[model samples]
Target chain A: MAGEASSGTFLQGLERGLAVIRAFSAQAPSLTLSEVARDVGLTPATARRILLTLEQLGYVRTDGRQFSLTPRVLALGWAYLSSLDLGELAGPYMEELSAATRESCSIATLDLPDIVYVARVPTSRIMTVALGVGARLPAYPTSMGRVLLAGLSSSELDVYLANMQTEQLTPRTVTSASLLRAAVDQARADGYALVDQELELGLRSLAAPIYNSRGRVVAALNVSAHASRSTPESLCEEVLPHVLCAADHITTALKHRGHL
Target chain B: MAGEASSGTFLQGLERGLAVIRAFSAQAPSLTLSEVARDVGLTPATARRILLTLEQLGYVRTDGRQFSLTPRVLALGWAYLSSLDLGELAGPYMEELSAATRESCSIATLDLPDIVYVARVPTSRIMTVALGVGARLPAYPTSMGRVLLAGLSSSELDVYLANMQTEQLTPRTVTSASLLRAAVDQARADGYALVDQELELGLRSLAAPIYNSRGRVVAALNVSAHASRSTPESLCEEVLPHVLCAADHITTALKHRGHL
Candidate 1:
């Protein structure tokens, strides 16, 4: 509000439009006119106006009486993807790790207090991790998030740890600041992290930081498996090595491409 | 513009703010105050206004006098990627094909006039086709795009082809609508498409339609190789079989997951 008030020319409509678009999701991909109004906390008339504008821009589409997102909404993602070289540089390496380990692999970039899975490769096995590209997991308890956090400066990590809201996701989720700091410190020392059954009941993951040419961690690469399939020792001994190799390869490629 | 005007209550401020955000890119990851105005074709005052508003909303950050995008932009892409099941279901198959051929493999859903690469697996050795996960390519010439187009009903294809603008990217680019239609027809008849030197010289690709449980082609999967490495015949003989099998695996997985 300070920035907007100081600049003195805020675009309230754009903010509302973005808010309305964000209101629809996996559980509420399709919304009736009244539902959109209720979800966005706007009057029905105002919500209808925003929806109509979004529909015109090809960001929203309607089926009969309910509104749903159109594929054109992908343009927003395209804009970010096209502008970022990290994904391109890390792609092959992620593929290699997925093949070598025979498990689902992913790359995530930290987005505030959560980690957003930006890229994922499933291994054609029947496994449930409840994580997908763009799916967010609390940073305190996820392997990829912790690996990414390890790269942050000490002061930045302190701030993050201070703001972290400890919640019980599962019995394994870390809730204490001192414990979280120790986990992050271990990740910093070892160059990898393992999260077992913290976010999901049977999910386990091993992750290593994917560094840019500057040796800064811009993303984290991970291998996720069901608890039955991947033991803690096996994942660290076997899967982590492969993932680190792949991350090293990706970092070299990024350096060659001048992404440093 | 027509769509917005018809709606009778358009948000011009939101449009201008989004345009300002879109002006930044990988090369221009951070921009000075004047640079933002130049790219978006707005006055510096107007650009400053939008930028300030965005900063207030946590979408943009200012470092001294320069402006850059924040991780919050990922929120927009996260919205789309999380809502769609295609990218998650198609990941492993794409990785397998990439590993087998040592080339980039992609899964794309058609957005008219363009195809957005929803998921991709890049091969380490080749950097020629390093399209990122959410990059977009012209639909008229890409192997994956044509395969998806071939799945559309005849009337739908007719309408799409009529409005398309084909820019010649290479000597082999299909500039004739009828010829392009014929190619689509051939893909429909054969259930696969091979496009060589159309979008990029020395690039050859093979693609197949990926059907959901209801048997609709919701996406297309493709293997792209250097022309010198793969002849059209070799692609058909070596890659087509695996492409088809990977597609079948994804389709079956989608059904089991109830994504269809």
Candidate 2:
């Protein structure tokens, strides 16, 4: 895969404009012109120009002093999701799994050190951190992340490990590179991964890899529950079967639809 | 509200870059360099530069010959969705409505002549067209669209009517401008709208307006089903109450969360 943009062909203005868009977050929904400037490390005038361009494109809306993204911004993400077609293909199966397990179920893909949820079927709110589609969590500590990481080639895994921070999110989170590597290896060998409160206290999850027609793991499916409600053994025995079945169902559907 | 971008302040480069991004769709996931240029009305050189820039920013990925958006592109949409916080607040209620009605339920906001779905819960596949978050459908032919249009101010409604293209989506679709206005007025008077097979053959839906804490209609909630499965009277009697209740629930939740 091509790694870097050759400087002769890159557009720096486009990058800066996207950076300005990325500067807004849930915590900072509306930002002043100077706030956007500071967040993206650009001048107020430059930020204003980019924001104005976004506004013109119908992506951003300003309420006099503060600027916030409009619903039109969702179209950008929708293009990606609709192209993937994961939600349409896997949604029914996920709903069934969520109902069967009475726990939250999600499908995610690895984005380096983080796993981004592409589709989710929530049964109950169990996580301290709210989980939804497009929500990201650390890869090493999440069951879905570990399953995705296990799908990577050895060289790719090495590169990921080299840059991985392995921060201690919870006391049970494995921080050591060797141990995390072993866990990923185990996930590959066992065809599933089960993490007990690694990402947060009282949260346990089990995940399995979802393969495409090319026999490549394109995504990971998981069933997450409270630790008090599900022991690791119970999760492995009960939820694991349901999650693996749902993953296979999604894989088959994707392959049949030529989406794989 | 700031309606338009000031002419002299906008960055044309940013607008062109986003146009390049928007050019990709579900029907065309990957495009060659020349194809991207032709699709976006840009020169091959400019398209290559923008693609290279997007590649550097990790939003676009290349498979040697073809270029497709990477999962990172979801981040742009996620920023908006997370900021809106609509999916988290309204999700469970939508699910409940879908379960109670055994149909697909969604919440959408008016984007002028189109309605953009913000949150959805699907119980079954009822329409030939797949409906998901960010999916836009013409407002005049959809239940949610009528409710949202009815919520608009008279001036805004006039602006919409002036520019509206009333296409014949289905035989039942109201194409007459005056008739469409009557439908909008009826929606405003009844506090709900029931559309019968206007968007597609054998599809019916009912929608109700959702208010923010400020008592402004912020969104519309709807339940859709097959025409054979649900008649207009059945939809109004059985599904309308659940939809309206869900709308009220969402509005109350948004109010308590200070999202209004």
Candidate 3:
């Protein structure tokens, strides 16, 4: 409905078009006209018009009946990624963290109520999900999520808590807003966050916030280790140092370059 | 101009908004409203409204004058990548190819006249550019580009050759359309493409095309190596076999799963 809102300054057609794109996910990659309209809360006629525009723009393709996106849509994301020097700066640090911990390392930033991965250095892991850049996870169950949540201002945190829904992904996952707030506060105090089997049953991760030159947390860095190989305490003791060291170095480099 | 065209079915606002997004590239990532209007050929007032809409949608952020994109825009690309089973199917094969060749392996698809990287398996190298998924390179000077170009139908190839400009990145680069067509034809006949120091000074690459269940070429796979480490002949002899095997295996897998 937010996208459907039209004002003098807000382009409803553009918003609805983007909504239609977002309506397609991994589970529902292709959709018929009515399906797209229903998913994005647009009329079939409007959806058809937007789809036609997208197809003309080379961002989408339709096989007569079902409409889907094309790889050219990636240029949109690249515009954002290439604009920032964060990913380029963080790539080496992420690689070093992955090397030191012998595990996967990733950097993510907060967006709305979820944290979106901006950069990653992956290891061949058995239990980890195959994820790449632009992958999203909820903000209350993961270590980076907590660090990012702690970075938010009180008003922003209030909006997030008001809008987000919490589910128990694992038994260790915190579901209540108060508990989530407490965890965020703890992360803020410690300058790091650790989650043990909160996202997955056998996964433990430790994360530290990466501050920009302005002392704002622009992103969070995390080392994800399998529980069979390391516990939260061990992760804190062994991997946290590397994570913090990388965080500090990244911050110093960003400050020197004024990258953020 | 194409986006600004409005028909009964084509939504002008939608195309214009997407054009605004595409106007920002790696070189001019952050642009002023006037610059964006000039780049996309829109009025200043129209660009402002579209930028306002994008900013409201959390895709673009403006620091008073210069407007830049946000990571939330990745969902547009994610919609396309998630819709395709290509990445998940090709990830392991790419990893194997990278491991076997001790070089970088990547899978890319033809989008318009460019090759957009969909998935990549990287090796830590000294001279290679730090590229990730969603990176684009012109489809006239590289191995994957030649393979993808070869995959296009005759009429499709005609449109591409007519529209795309060839640039001489290096002295070895073929700038003539006839030469490019010859290379593409050679790639098609050989079932692979190899380019030696055409795109870069000391880089060599070998590529193979992957087809779908219906025998349509969908993506191209390639192995990138350094000239100091491997020659074009060596790339063909040592790395090309692995690339073809992986390409064949990926095609078979996609066929079995009807994944394309």
lDDT (Cα, 0-100) at B105 in candidate 1: 81
- For model 2, fnat equals 0.55
lDDT of each: 0.77, 0.82, 0.83
**Candidate 3 residue spans exceeding 4 A from truth:** A1-6, A125-129, B1-7, B125-129
Model 1 Cα lDDT, one tens digit per residue, A1-260: 21222214666666777787788676776788899999888888778888887787777777657886666666665455445555555767776788899887888888779887666666763222245445677788889989999999999999998998978899998989999999999999999999999978899998988777678898888898899997999898888889889878877787787633
Error of 1 at B109 (Å): 2.5
Candidates ranked by lDDT: 3, 2, 1
Residue lDDT tens for model 2, B1-260: 02222247665556667887777777877789999999888877778878887888888888777888777877888788778777778888887888899887888887776898877766743221256567888899999999999999999998898889988988899988889999999999999999999999999989999998888888899998988898898888888889889999999998998843
Q: Each model's TM-score?
A: 0.76, 0.88, 0.94
Q: lDDT at B138 for candidate 3?
A: 86
Q: In candidate 3, what are the lDDT values of residues B148-231, reduced to their tens digit?
A: 999889999888887778788999998888888999999999999999999999988899999989888889999988899987
Ranking by TM-score: 3, 2, 1
- Model 2 pairs whose backbones collide: none
